[model samples]
Structure formats: structure tokens, C-alpha cells
Target: MLLPPKDSVLRQASFTNFWISRILSSTSFQMLSVAIGWQMYALTHDAFSLGFVGLAQFIPMVLLTFVVGHAADRFDRRKIVCLCQLIEGGIAALLLVGNMAGWLGREQILLAAAILGACRAFEGPSSSALLPQLVPKHILQQAIAWSTSAGQTAQILGPSLGGLLYSLGASCVYGAATIALLTAGILTCFIRVERSERKTEPVSLRSVFLGLEFVYRHPAILGTISLDLFAVLLGGATALLPIFAQDILHTGPWGLGLMRTAPAVGALLMSLILAYYPLQRAVGLKLFAALAVFGLATMLFAISTNLVVSLVALLLTGASDVVSVVIRSSLVQLQTPDEMRGRVNAVNSLFIGTSNQLGEFESGVLAGFIGPVPAAFLGGLGTIAVAGLWMYLFPSLRRLRSLSES
Candidate 1:
């Protein structure tokens, strides 16, 4: 019998640890997010407040991303990661207490959600920057794929768990999330860090902005990042999923969980297939096409009445999202040098953070105004339109070849 390569065992171990950490951290945070959204909407029946939930964290993230990125470059990344994990655990614990005491009115819950987002703002860049340190540079792409798979897998499981737990009460969900975050902190303690390879120049706000400027000037890097950002920003209907599950689909919390997980199921399967075989050929064209598919999937989901149809739509949406993530992350990692990775990634965080959290805000506002279905459909159309505009605007992105070929 023919067997796989001899190095497969070593590769699998690194992949396992890398992915397990992602799953744990993502599950802790996402479960909290779904629960917060579910509980807040239940209490207030307002989508705008749901938007506010993201605003709280995003403001802090935008403010601190440069500092956090600088710190990641300057300090031991493993320790920085551990500290963030611990802070998140503390935040989660506070949320649990707020939920349990019945002291958490909508205002208090919003405050807690903001604080959690603040922690995540720091956590995200550090975690992303830490990946290259975990594996050989050759397998960095694989590590990213596995990490996305892990995150999506958690996305699949976490919301369902959150919805089920939320049915029992918000306290249960918050408590479980807190425990998961604390465990994440404990796991970070196990990640050993060598001294940073980054060169420390005197840190200044102007220096940080230099990194942002660099991203702007690099078309392949900026273009790919913007493609993903705008695509997801306009098309992402996550904030309105609760409405679809309850009002449209005529299902309860369980259905909401299923909808949340649907994308992950699609992304995970796509990632697994791509892991063994690279998606390197004609990557640029594929990226644009993926976003187009993403827009179409969201549009289909917006009109979908059947549970199975909605699930399939969301699954395609997730798969497309994964494509965007890989292409964008690869562009950044390839263009960035080891010394500037932290600062550059910090800027990347701002781009992505604004897109995701602000996208949530956009979804909530649009849904509140036009109704959830129309908002989602319109958002998808907007995403497709942006991709078309981008294709015309960025000639460099269209011309990009594989990193190996380059």
C-alpha cells in the first residue's frame, strides 16, 4: 500500500495544537457574543442596541491596535498572548456575575459587551502575529488554514451551545463562556516564547502610522485585504440571524445556532479539501469570484424560507469567506517582514476589525430600517458592486500571481 509522506506525523501535531488553541479561544468569545445578542434582543427587541454591542469593543480596538501590535513586536509574544487571555477571562467572569445577579439590565449588558470587545481587539492581533512563530515558515499557509478551520468549527459548535444554554438562562451561557476563557488563559501559559526577532526602533505614533501607510501603498496587499473587508462588511448578515431564525424560519434558539454554524460547516469542509491540495493557481481571480459567490449566497439566504435552503446558503457564504481570509492573510504575511509584522498586523487588525464589527453595526441599522431580509439582500448587492469597482480600481491585484511564482 502507498503511504503518505514520512513528515506527516510531525505536521499533524503542529496542526493539532495550532487548531486546538484557535477552537478554544474562538469558542469562548463567540459563545459569549451569541448569548449577548440573544439576551439583549430578547430584553429590548431592538437591533440598534445590538449594533452598540459591537461599537463598544471596536472603538477600543481601533484605538489600541497599534499599541498592541507594537507590544507584540517588543515583548514576548507568548506572554503578551497570556496576559490578554487572562484579561479576557476576567472580563468573562464579570459578565457571568452580571448575568447571574439579575443586576444586568440592558445598559449593563451593553457595557460588558463593549469591554469584552476591547479585550478581543487586543487578543486578535496578538494571536494572528503569533502564528508564524508556531510553525515552520513553509507550513505557515497550512497553519492559517487549520486555524480558520478551527475557528469556523467553533463557530459551528459555539452558537448552538450558546443558544441551548441561553434557553436555560443567560447565567448558564455566561458562566460557561467565562470558564472557557479562563481555560484559554491556562493554555496560553503552555505556549513557550523565545525572545522576539523584531528590531526595536523608538516607538512613536508617527512610526505606527508608517505601517498603516505601507499597507495603503502596497496594492496586492491592500487590495486583497479590502476585497475581503468590503465583501464581508456588506454581505455579512450575522447580526440579523436571530430575526431569520425566530421570525422568518419559525424556529427557536436551536435554529439560530444551526444558522450560525452553517457557514463554519462549509468553511471547514472547504479548508480540509484545500489543505491537502493548495489553492495557489489563479488565486487572484478565484478571490474575486469567491466574494461574488459570497454575495450571491447571502442574497439567496435573505430570500430563503426553508431551513435547509438557508443552511445551504450560509454554508456557501462561509466557504467563500474562507477563501477571502486565506488570500488576504497570505498577501499580508508574504509582504510583511518579520521585524514589522506586529505593527503591520496591527494595521491589518484595524482594517479587519472595522469591517467585521462595523459590518455588524451596518447590518443591525439596515435591518432595523428596511427589515432583516431586505437589508441582507441589499447588503449582498452592495458587496458585489464593491468587488466590481475594486476589479477596475486595482490593476495590481488583478495581476498578482502565486507567491512561489512571484
Candidate 2:
């Protein structure tokens, strides 16, 4: 049997460094999330306030998507990623200081989140576009799987560690996040990639929307991206997890940490499996099936009051999501032209950021009005509905058999 693709990809120094940086950066972000969620809930004791956190981040990313995508295509992606990490580190430091001095109000946290979102708007496209440059075409799928696994591992560690540190003090969690983010930035600086070759063609309105045009033209890509967008946009249950931890589960920070980590555990396991085995046949059918499972699992989580049951449901949700992620990511990277990868990825990032951050906002608002449990239940149904709708509308997506086929 062949050695796992992860092992092969890791043999290259650049890929290894990039992988390490991913782990560190993901860890920092995860820690920051726990700290922010706990602190915000403690301060305001309102569900809407939690939603506002997502809103604060989402607005800047949406506003800056076009420019950030352009910059990624036009500039050195590594440098852009490094700079973004540095800025995120600064934000973590600010949070640390504010928490220590007791002046970090809800507004200040939201402001920091907005700035961090702006940095990520640039960072997401650049970092995503840089991946294909790191490894051979044959191992790209493995690389994506392993990279996601590393992120999932960080998500597992970060939340638990963050929650434990929160018990010490919110400032302690922020302090740890600051260190992790700065370390990631430093590691990113060591990655060596050639500068992007600039196109001789002058910039024009058409050039600006090229990524959008590509996705519009390719129904397969469009189907997959939009499928995830609408599904997660309506179905994401993460925003109301704090409420679930506190009121529904009747667990404290420790329980909250477990809740956060459960999905990652599932995702990490699934990613490892795909890394070794890979998907060979019936890829599209598998993708749709996984999404349907994710929706069902989410619905299970919504109604469960038992911690163990909720954890299991969340684990299944993460496991199901990994299949979709691996397939979708491969399609996006492999199908896109190198020159347009950055812009296309930026558009994809916009969908992702919208699904995540805006999804959180929607969850919070709905939870405030309708209650957390019902909100989650409704979201799950919406997810299921999207899967069915997309299955009917995008027969091309359903018929997709392999990444290599695209």
C-alpha cells in the first residue's frame, strides 16, 4: 500500500511550514472564539448580543471582498497572509489588555471583531490561493485533506484550552491567543513562494468581476458553492451554542469547551480517513448524502437536552461536514485557473464568511425572538430543504463523479 498523501505532502519544507502555520492560526482563532463568546454572554446576558458579534465581523468581510480578492491575485500571497496574522495578533493583544484592565466592553469587542474580519477578508483568499503552489497536482487533494485535519486538530485543542484558561481569567485566554497568533505569523514569514506573475492586460471592470464570472459560467462550481452557502446560512447551529451550554445543557465553561470541540473531533477523524483512502467514485452522490446527514444530525442536536446526546449529534454533524468540505475544496482549487485562483477563492470566501458570520447573526436574532431550541430546529429543517432543492436544481452537481473529472 502507498504511504498516506499527508506524509508525502509533509516531506516538502514549504508545505510543512504552511501546515504548521495553519495549525497555529486556527488555534488562535478558536481560542479567541471561546473567549469572546463567553465574555460577551457574561457581560450582556443576551442572545442578540452574541449575534451582533457575528454581524460585526460579517459586514467588513462583505464590504471588502472584491478589493481583497484583487490584492491576493496581484500581490505576494505569503506576505499578505503574514501581515494579516500580525494584525490579528495585535487584535488579540488589545483584547488581552482590555480584559485585564476591565475596560473591554461589548462595543470594544465588536470593534475589534470588525477589524479582525477586515484582516481575514484579505487573508482568506491569499492563503487559499497559496495552497496549490505548495504541492504537486497529484497530492493536492491529500494536501487539502491534511490541511483541514490540522485545522480540525487545532479546533479540538483550542476550545478546551481556551475554556480552561477562561477559568483562570478571560485575560488569560486572550494572552494565550496572542502568543499563538504571533507565532503563526512568524512561521508564515518562512514560507518561500515566487511572487505572482502580473498580467499585462490593464485593469478593467471585467477584470474585477472575473472570479464572479467564472463561477457564474461553471454550473458545477456554482452548484457546490451555492449549495453550501444556503444550507449553512440557514442551518448553522453554532451561534446559539452558548445558550445551549448554559441553559439547555446546564453546563459551565468546561461543558461549553466540550461542545465546541465535539464537532472538530468528528471532522478530524473524517479528514484523516479521507486523507488515506480518498474519494474515488460517486463523489457527487456522496457529497449530497453527507449534507443530508449533516442536516439530520443538526436537528438531533437541537432537541437533545442530554450532554452526551448533544455531543454525539455534533460529532456526526462535523463528520458529515468533512465530506462536503473535502469535495468542495478540491473542486474549487482544481477547476480554477491559476491566474484566477485568488479572485475565485475570494468569492468563495465571501460565501463562506457569509455562511459562518452572517449565519451566526441569523441564529442569534432568531434565538432571541423564538428561543434557542426552536431556532436550531428550524435551521436544521432549512438545511434539509436546501439539500433537496439543490439536488433537483443542479443535476450536474449531483452527477459529478470525481474531482479529476472537472
Top TM-score: which candidate number? 2
lDDT of 1 by residue, 87-151 (tens): 77777788778767767778887777777777777777777877776666665666677777777
Off by over 4 Å in 2: 1-11, 36-53, 94-111, 169-171, 194-200, 240-256, 303-306, 361-378
The TM-scores of all predictions, comma-separated, are 0.84, 0.85
lDDT assessment of candidate 2: 0.86
- Residue 147, model 1: lDDT of 72
Root-mean-square deviation (CA) per prediction: 3.8, 3.6
lDDT of 2 at 391: 89
In candidate 2, how many Å is residue 67 off? Answer: 0.9
lDDT of each: 0.78, 0.86
The TM-score obtained by model 2 is 0.85
Candidate 2 weakest lDDT stretch, 10 residues: 1-10
